[model samples]
Target: MALFYKSNNAGVPIGWIAIMLALLASMGGFIFGYDTGQISDILLMEDFKLRFATCETPGVVASCDFTVVREGLIVALLSIGTLAGALIGAPTADYLGRKYAMIVECMVFIVGVIIQMTARHVWQQFAVGRLVSGLGVGALSAAVPMYQAETAPSQIRGSLTATYQLFITFDCISIGARDIPGAGSWQTVVGIGIVWPVIMIVGMMFMPESPRWLAKHDRIEEAAAAIAATRGIRKDEAMSHPVVSKEIEQIRNHVQYESKMKGGWLDCFSLKDKILYRTLLGMSLQSLQQLTGANYFFYYGASIFQSVGIEDSFITQIILGAVNFFCTFGGIYVMERFGRRRPLIIGGIWQACWLFVFAAAGTAVDPEQNDSIGKLMIVAACMFILGYAMTWAPGIWILIGETFPTRTRAKQGALSTASNWTWNFLLAFFTPFIVSAIQFRYGFVFAACNLLGAVVVYFFLYESSDLTLETVDQMYCDPECKPWNSRHWAPAGYESRHNLVEQTKAAEAHKPIVGGEESRREDVEKSGDEGRTERC
Candidate 1:
C-alpha cells in the first residue's frame, strides 16, 4: 500500500489535441447529465405533471395526482433504452469507427429528444421517447471512453477518461430550470437536448477516429495519421516518433494476437488467462458504481429533500449538484497524482461512513418533529455525495476504460456500460417504492454496498494508473502478476516502472510500423533496426 504513492509519476505528454478530442467526445456525457438531471426538476414541475403525468385531476395542476408507477417509468425507460443502445453501440463502433459511431449515437439521441419534446399529453409516449433517447446516450457512453482511453496518453488517461463522468455530473443547466419556470416552453426543454448531440455530430467530423479502432479494422495509414494527430506530430514523422511508433506497434501486436485467438463470450470466460474473471470484474465494478447510491440524489433529489420538509428542494438539489460538479475535478487530480486504488478504496469507506450516518440521522429520528434532524439529513447527504463524486463516480470509468484488452474493448466495454444502465433502470424504477416503504432507511443498503466495493477493490483491482493501455493488457496476460502487489510491476523487458515512459526512452516494442506511406514505413523500419527513431 505504501508503494501506491511511489507509482504516481506522470509519464509522457501526448499533446493538447488528444485532450480536446476527449472533451469533445465527453459532450455526450454532458448531454447525458443535463437531460437526466432536468427530469428530477421536470417531475416536480406542476405544468410538466399536468401535461405528461397520469393524475386524478388531469386538468387542474393544484389537485393533480402523481402516481409512483408512472413517475418511475418516465425515468426507468431511459435506462432500459440506454441498455439496448449500449449493446448496439459496441459493434457499431467496431464496424463504423469511433468517430462515425459517435455521430450515429448523437443523431439517435436527437431523434429521441424530439419525440419527448413533441409529446402532446401521453406519459407513455414520453416514456417511449426516453427509451429512444437512451439508446443514444447508452451508445455514446460506450463510445466516448473507448475513444478517450484509446487516444489518450497513459499517465493522464485516467483523468481524461474520467472526464466523461465529470460531464455526467454537470447538472448545472438542467438543475437551474426549476427556478426558471416562466422562461419558455417547457416542452422545448427536451428540445434543448438536441443542442449537445448536434454539437458533437459536427465536432466528430474534424476529430480523428480512434487510432486503435482504425488499426483493428486494418486501416493502417489512417491509423498512422490519427496517432500523429494525437501526438501533434507530422503524419510523415509519426512512425519516427518513438511514442507514436511504440503505440502503433502495441496496437498492431494486440490486433494480430487477437486474430490468432478465438474471442466471444465463450472464449472470454474460458479461464485460460483469467479473461472471464477480468470480464466479470469490469462489468461488476460498473454495476457497483451505480449501486453506490449517488443517483438517489440526482434522480430524485427534489422529492427526497421535500419529504424531509424542505420547502425549497430545488435549492438543495442544486447544492448537491454543485458539490458533485466540483468534487469531480478533485477526483481527476487525485487519480492522476495518487493512482486509482487508494482513492477508490478510501472513497468507498468514506462513503459508507456517511451513508450510515445519513440513514441513521434521516430515519433514526423523526425529521418532521425535529428541524435540526432535517438539516442534519442534508449535511449527511452532501457528505455522502462528496465521497461518491470524488471516488467511485470517476474511478469506475477510468478503470473499465483501461481494463479490457483491445480485442474485447468495444464489446466488453459495452457489456460493462450496459451493466451500469441495467442497475440504473432498476434503481430508477424501484426507488420510489423503496422510499415509500422505508424512506431514508434506503441509505443503509447502499452503505453496505459501498463497504463491499472496498473489499472487492482491495482483493481484485490492480493498479493501472500510469500503464499504457496495451501494457495493462500485458499485466493481465502475465500469470505471475498479483493484484495487491502490482504497485511496482512493469511489463517484461522494461526498465522504468511505467511502460509508456520506457517507450519514450527508445525501448523496442514488438514490431515496426507497417502499411503506412512507403516513405514513412521505410523511415520507421530503418529506425527500428537502428534501435530508435530519429523523428524526436
Candidate 2:
C-alpha cells in the first residue's frame, strides 16, 4: 500500500559487461514488439487487404464473415506459432543453454520473415509464414528473459529484464510506415524486423552462457570463469571473490535440492511442492496481462478506435504507440526503485478506472454524430494504455523471470510465456467478434478482468525485488513462506545481502601468502563456506 523501496545495500555495481549482455538478449523483445506493433497497422492497408483479404476496394473494411475470419487468422497465426515456440523453446533452452537456444530462435525468425516477405497468397502460405514467425517470437520471448535474469545481479534484474518490454514500446519504429503507401513498404518493414534477430544471433556468438546454468550443470570452474567475464574481472580473481563464489555455491545448493526432488508438470500442480504455487502465480499473472484487454489495444487498436467513430485510426494508433513507448520508462524506474508488487496493484486500479470510463464514454453518445464522444473514447483508450504500459506489461516479464527456482526456470518460463501468447492469440482472434457483440460495452469486460487481477496480485503475488537469485530459492523452500506476507520477508542470516566491496576487501586481506597457492585456495573455500552458512 505504501512506497516499498528495495535498494542495493550491498553496493554491488552492475558492470557494463552485464548491461551489454542484457541489451543483446533483449533483441528478442524488439522482435516481439515490432511484430505486434507492425501488424496492428498493416492489416488495414489497401495492398495488405487486397493480397490477403481479397477485398474488392481499397480502404474499405472487410464486411463479410469470411473476410473477417481471414483477417483474424492473419493477425492471430503469429501468436499460434509463438505458442509452439514457447513449448519447444523450454527443453531447447534447458538442453542447449540460453545463448544457443536464442541463436536457433534467430534462425527460425529469419525463416519466418523470409516467408512472410515472399508470400503472394493469403490464408495458406501467409498464415504459415506468420505461424513460423510466431515460433521465433515464442522462443525469443522464452529464452531472452531467462538469459537476462540468470546473468543479471538481483539489484537490477527487474529493470534489465523490463528492457524487453522497453524494446516492445520502442518497436513503435514502423509506425511511420503507415504514412507510406504500397505493399512493398510493408514487405520492407517486415524485412527490417529481421535485423534485430540477426543482431541477437550474431551478438550471442560472443556472449557468455548463464553462470547459474553452468553451476547447475556441475561446471563450476566454467561458471566461475563466466562470472569473471560478466563482471569484467580475471578468472582466478573471480574464483577467489567471496561474493561470486557464494553465488556459485547458492546455485549448486539449489540445483542439488531440485535434483533430489522429482519434477514434471505434475510436480508443478502438487500441493506437496511449494514450486507449484510459484508456477501458478507466474502463469496466472501472465494470463492476466493479456486478459486485462491490453492486447485489444495492441492487436486491434485501429479497430477499437474505428468502432468508436474515429475516422483516422492510423494517426491515433501512432499517437498511442508514442504514449505506450514513453510511459514504459515509468515502469522501468518503478520496477527498479519501488519493487514489483505496488506498481502492479496501482496499475491495475488505474486501468480499471480508465477502462470503465472508456466503456461509459463509448455508450454515452453516438460516435457517428457526436464527435466529442469519439474524442473522449480516444482519450480514455490512451489513459488505459498508459496504465497498462507502466504496470502489467513490464511487470509480468519481471515476475516470470524471477519467480521460479533455477531447477524449473526454463520449463516454467516456457509455460508462462506460452500462457501469455495463448491468451494473446485468443484475444487477437476474437476481438473483432467481441467488439461486434458487446459494442461500446466491451471495455466493461476488460475492466472487470483487471479488477479481478488486482485481487490476485494482492493475495498471490510475492516480493522478489532486490533479493539474490539464491535467496529467492530459499524463500520458496521454507514451509512458512506465504505469498501474501512476503513483502516483509528475508532469508535467515541473509549472507547474500552483504556489501560486495567490503566482502571482497575482507577476503583479500585474509589471504595466507606464506603457504602460497594452496593457502589462498583454502582461504577462498573457507570464505565460501562462511558465506553459505550466513545465507542459510
Candidate 3:
C-alpha cells in the first residue's frame, strides 16, 4: 500500500540518482538502435560494396556486386546472433544476476566494436564481429530493463524504465542522420555506435545491486542494505517499516517455494491455462512488433528514400531518424499518465492508418511525379514511427514484466524475450527477400500486418494500468475478467490463493491468539541476518 520504502526520507535525493543510473544503463538500447538504423546508411555506401565484393568463381573476376549481398549478410548475421543471445540471456540473467550479466555483455559488445571498426575482409571475420555485437545487444535488451525495474521504486518505475525506449529512438535518429561526407566513410557511423556500450560499462560500475534479487536469494540483511544504499536510506530505518519488511519476506518466501516446486521443462508446460495464455500473449505482442515492419524503416529508410529518387538519400535517412527520436518522446511523456491500454489502442489504429497511407503512396505515386508522392510517403513513415514509439515498442516489454506472478516472472520473461528475438531474426533476415519480391512496395504488406495486430489487441488485451501485480493475475485467471462474460472484471471461478485480500486475511488469521505478535516480531529480527549480500 505504501508508495515508497520507509527508509526513504521525505526530501531524499535518491530519485535523481536512480534516474541517472537507469539512463546510463539504458545506453545499451541506444547502441542497439544505432546499429539497427546505421544499416540503412551503410548499405548506401560505395565502401560497403567494395568490402563485400564476391568473385564469380575462385580467382575469377568478381561478378557479383559485393555491396548488395554484404549489407544483407551483415544485417542478417546480426539478427541471427541476437536470436541466439536472447535464448541464452534469460537463463544467464536468472543465474548470474542482472548486473554481472550486463558486465559480460559489455565486454562482448566492446570486442564486436573493435572487430567491426578495423575489419578489412567482409566474409568470415566481419560476420563474426557482427554476431558478437548482436549477442551483446540481444542480452542487453533483456538485462538492462530487468535490472532497472528491480532497482527502481515502484512509484516512478514506469517513467524511469521508459528512458530505455527513449534513448533507443534517439540513437536510431542519430545514426540515420550521421554523415562523414565521404563516399565510403560509413565506418564513422559504425564507430559512433560503440559509444553507448562504453557509457554503460562506466555507469554500471558504480550502481548498487538489485534488492529484489538479493531478497530472492534469502539474503535479507544484504537486500536491506542494497535497498538503503540505492535509495539513499539508512538500513535500520528501511527495515523498520512493516510494509517494506512484509514485501521483502514475501519475495523470500516466493523464491523458497519456487525451489521446492522445481520441475523439468514439462512442468513449465503443465502450468494452468491462464498462465499459458498470459505467456503466449506476451510472446505474441513482442513478435507482432517486429512483423509490422517497423525495423525496415529504421534499418533501411535511406535505401527506401533512394528508391523514391530522393536527393541526398543519406540526409533523408538522418531526417527520418530525427523524426523517430522526437516522436518516441510522445510515448514516454504520456505512458504513465495515459496508462498502457489507451496508448496501445490509439497507437495501433494510428499505425494501421499510416501504413495504409504509405502503401497507397507507394502503389500510386510515380517517382518522377513532382516529388510530391515521395514527400507523402515520408510523412506516412514518420506517423508509423510515432505510433510504434508510443505503444507497441516499449509497452510490450512493460506488459511482459508485469503480467506474470513472481513465481513465474523470470522464466516467462525469458521465454517471451526469446520469442521476440526469434521473430526479430526472421524479420531482419527476410526483409531483403521481401523487398526484392514486392519491390519498394513492401509498405502494403506491413500495413496489412498492422491491421491484423490492431484487431488482436482489441479482442485479447485488457486494461492493466493502476492495478497492482496481484490484481493483474486475478484479472487474467478469474473467468469474470474474460471479455463479454462479466459486467465488471473480477476473479470469478479461480480461487484467490495469491490475491492480496486473501493473503492479508490469512496472515492476520495466523496471528497467535496469545502472544503470537511478539513471537512474529522475534522471528523477523532473527531472520534478518540470514539473508545474502554480494558487492560487485
Candidate 4:
C-alpha cells in the first residue's frame, strides 16, 4: 500500500505522474459527462415513458416523444444540486483539504449511483440519485482541478489540468457508444455511470495527499515526502532539491502569513484592488463558457439531433463526442504556444459566427428539407466545438488557477467554480423553455451569447501566457497600470520557489512580524516588487 508521489529531482520524468493523477481525478469529469449525456438517451426510452405515464396527472398521458419541458426540468434540477455542491466545496476543500473532500464526494456519488440504478420511477431517480450525483460531480469539478493544479509541476500544468476535459469527452463517447441501440435499454447505459467514480475511489486509496495542501497546513516535511513518493523520487533527493525546498519554504511562509489576516468571506470582496478584479474575471470566465451553450449539447444532444429529423440520435451523440475529443486536442496543442488571451478572442469570435450559421440552418429548413440543413448544422456545430475546444473550455481553468495568489487560491477557485455551476444550472434549466418557446430559433440564443462572450473577452481579459504566477499578480495589483490600460509587462522568473524565498527574506528586513496581516502584506508587496523589478 505504498503511496504514489511526485518527484522533485530534475529530469526524473514527472509527466507520467501528472498524466496518471490527471486521468484518475478526471473520473469526476467522466461521471459528469456520462450522467449528463445519458439523460438525453434515457428520455427517449419506453421505460421512461411508462414511468412518466404512471405519474401523469389523471387523464394526461405521457408522450413517447421527448418534451423540452421535462428534459429541461431534469437537467436544471441536477444543476441546482451542482450549484450547491460547488458553493460548499470551496469551504470543504479549504477546511478538509482537496483529497478528503474528494473522498466524501465519492460517497455522495455512490449514493447517487445506487439510487439511479434501482429507482422504479423517473421522478424518483431524477429527484434523488441524479441530484445527488450532480452534487458530487459539481464538487469534483471544482476540487479535482484544484487538486491537480496544486499537485502538478509547473512545466505541464496546463496539459494536466486540461485532462479534465479529455476525460469528459471520453465519457461522452463511452456513454454514446453504450447507447447505440437507443433508449430501449437505459438501465444498461445508466448502470455504466457508476464505473468511473468507483474507479476514482480505488485510485484515491493509492494516491498521495496534495503537497500544496500539506504545505498549507504547516506540514512541510510531509509535503516534501508526499512529493517525492508521487514523483518516484528518493525522499532524500526530493528534500534536497533547491526548487522543492524553496517551494516548501514559500508555502510555509505564505500559510503562516495568512494565519494572521482576518479570514472571512468578506475578505474576498473587501479587496477592491487587482485581486478583486481577477476574482471577478475568473468567475465571469466560467459563467461565459456556460452561457456559450456548450453543456447544452452535452445535456441535450440527442434531442437536438431529433429536432433535425435524425432517426438515430445515438449515432449523432457518438459523432459529437468524437468531434469534441479531437477538437479539445487542438486546444491543448495551441494553448501554451499561442498564449491564453489570443486563442480565447479568436475562438470566441469563430464560435459566435458558427453559432449563427447553425441557427440559420435550423430555422430556415423544413422537416422535409432537414437533410441538407441538418448536415450543414452538424458541420457548424463541429466548428463551434472546434472553437470552444481550442479556447475557453480549458483555458479558463488554466487562467483561474494561475491568476490567483497561493494564499487565496483554493477559496477563489471554489468561488469561481460555484459561479460556473450556477450559470450551468441557469442554462440547463432555461434551455428547454428556450427551445420550446423559440422552436427552431434556439440556435440564435446560443449565437447571441457567444457574441457577448467574445466582446467580454476582448475587453476584460489579458494575456497570461509565459508569465509566472507572481508576475501575473503584479500586472493586476500595480496601481500605475489602470484597468483600461493595454500595457503588457514582461515578468521575470519570480515564480521559482527560490526567488520567493529571497523576496521573503528581503521583506523581513523592512517590517517586523507583528501579525499575519502585516506579514501577508509584506509577502504580497515583496512578491509584487519582485515581479516588477524582474520586469525592469
Please report the candidate that would top lDDT against the real structure. 1
Tens digits of per-residue lDDT, candidate 3, 1-536, equal 11232211222124355767678877877887777766655655555545555646543334435555565677778777777776677777777777788888878877887788777755567677889998888888777777776776544556667778877776443334344454226667777777778778878877767766776677787776665555555657767644346546545654564466553334445456366776777777778878777888876666557655766755776676677777777766667666666677677778878888887777776644636777777778888887888787777766765676555666666667778778777776677788778755787777777777777766777655434343455466555465333224433221232232332323322322223455434433332232211000
Off by over 4 Å in 1: 1-11, 55-58, 175-184, 307-309, 495-536
Residue-wise C-alpha lDDT for candidate 1, range 248-352, written one tens digit per residue: 876776677667777664665666556777888988899999989988877777655765666675676678889999999988888887788898899999999
Better lDDT candidate (1, 2)? 1
**So what's the TM-score on candidate 2?**
0.88
Clashing pairs in 4: 4-230, 5-229, 5-230, 5-231, 6-230, 6-231, 7-231, 260-516
Model 1 weakest 10-residue run by lDDT: 1-10
Better of 2 and 3 by lDDT: 2
Better of 1 and 4 by TM-score: 1
Best-fitting candidate, scored by TM-score: 1
Residue runs of model 2 more than 4 Å from their true location after superposition: 1-10, 55-66, 175-183, 303-310, 494-536
The alpha-carbon lDDT assigned to residue 212 of candidate 2 equals 79
Question: Cα deviation in Å at residue 264, candidate 4?
Answer: 2.6
Q: How many Å off is the CA of 527 in candidate 3?
A: 18
Q: How close is every model to the real structure, measured as TM-score? A: 0.89, 0.88, 0.80, 0.82
lDDT of 2 by residue, 1-536 (tens): 11112232223434566778888998888898888777766666656666666655545646412366676777789999999999899889989998899999899998998998988755578678888999989988988988988888666789889989889887665556655667775787788988998888888898889987887778888887777666656667777766577567766766676677766655666565467787788789999999888777766666556645555756656777788889898889888777888888888899999999888987777665766777777788899888888888899998888887777788889889999999988887777787888787988989999988999998888778867676666666666667666766655423232333233333333423332455435433443343343322
Instruction: Write one digit per residue (lDDT tens) for candidate 4, span 141-237.
Output: 8888888777765546677677787677764433334435533366677777777888998887777678877876777888987666555556777
